[model samples]
Target: MTARTDQAEITALVDRFFLALDTREFTPGWARAYLTDDARMDAPVGAKRGAEAVRTAETALLRFARTQHFASGVVTDAAFGTDDATASWNAYMVHVHHSPAADPLFVVGGRWEATLRRTPEGWRFSAMTVHVVWTRGEPPTAEPG
Candidate 1:
């Protein structure tokens, strides 16, 4: 594929990932669809390896009644290898909950860096690092009532 085509594909993959998360449909199948088997995700707390681990971490964040992830200003670099690429994007997100009453709990502005691979199934994230540059309000938690 041409460089332009590759970049488009990468961008789409990134968008799909965030959309899936926003919809809270992060099942194991969803993880396998978007990430490599041994993918690594480094977040504020730490890092998780493999699709299962990543799924678990994402699932925990579902404590919020609702969430949305939006990515913009995406930039992608395609390497010589057909399957290798890298991308960076800014993410604006909001987390909301309604356990007691509905309210917006947090506003997170973050950056994402990802290493991608074009697997037989299509492009998948090999590794991703998320840095929370700034956030307003405390992050929500799933504590026992």
Candidate 2:
């Protein structure tokens, strides 16, 4: 494939990665479909390896009632000799939780750095790292019984 084509594929793959996070649900199928078998993810929380580990890490977002991930300003730097593609993007994340007293919202600003590779199925994330630059507001809380 041409360079432009490869870039497009990588962009689309990144888009899907964000979309999966926006879903607010971390299903096993989603991981199987989106991430390569040996994918690794690093974030402020910790690091995880493989698809199952990635799923577990992402699912932690479920602590919030609702979640959304906005990925923008994507810039990809690719090495010509290798099939690997690396990209950086600005991320705006919102998390909402409802309590009997009031609803809490958390807004987070961060950057996503990901390395993708072409697989038999398509382009998949081989590694991803998130750097949380800043955060504001409070996360959601469960209702007290």
Q: lDDT winner among the candidates?
A: 1
Local error of candidate 1 at residue 135 (angstroms): 0.3
Q: Count the backbone clashes (under 3 Å) in each candidate.
A: 0, 0
lDDT of each: 0.81, 0.76
**Maximum-TM-score candidate:** 1
In candidate 1, how many clashes are counted? 0
Model 1, residue 67: what's the lDDT? Answer: 82
Q: Which portions of model 2 miss their true places by more than 4 Å?
A: 100-103, 140-145
Estimated TM-score per prediction? 0.89, 0.84
User: How do the residues 1-145 of candidate 1 rate in per-residue lDDT, one tens digit apiece?
Assistant: 7888888988998898888887877644678878888999888656889965675557656667778889999999988656799999999988776465444578889999999998888889999999999998777666423
Determine which window of 10 residues in candidate 2 has minimal summed lDDT: 136-145
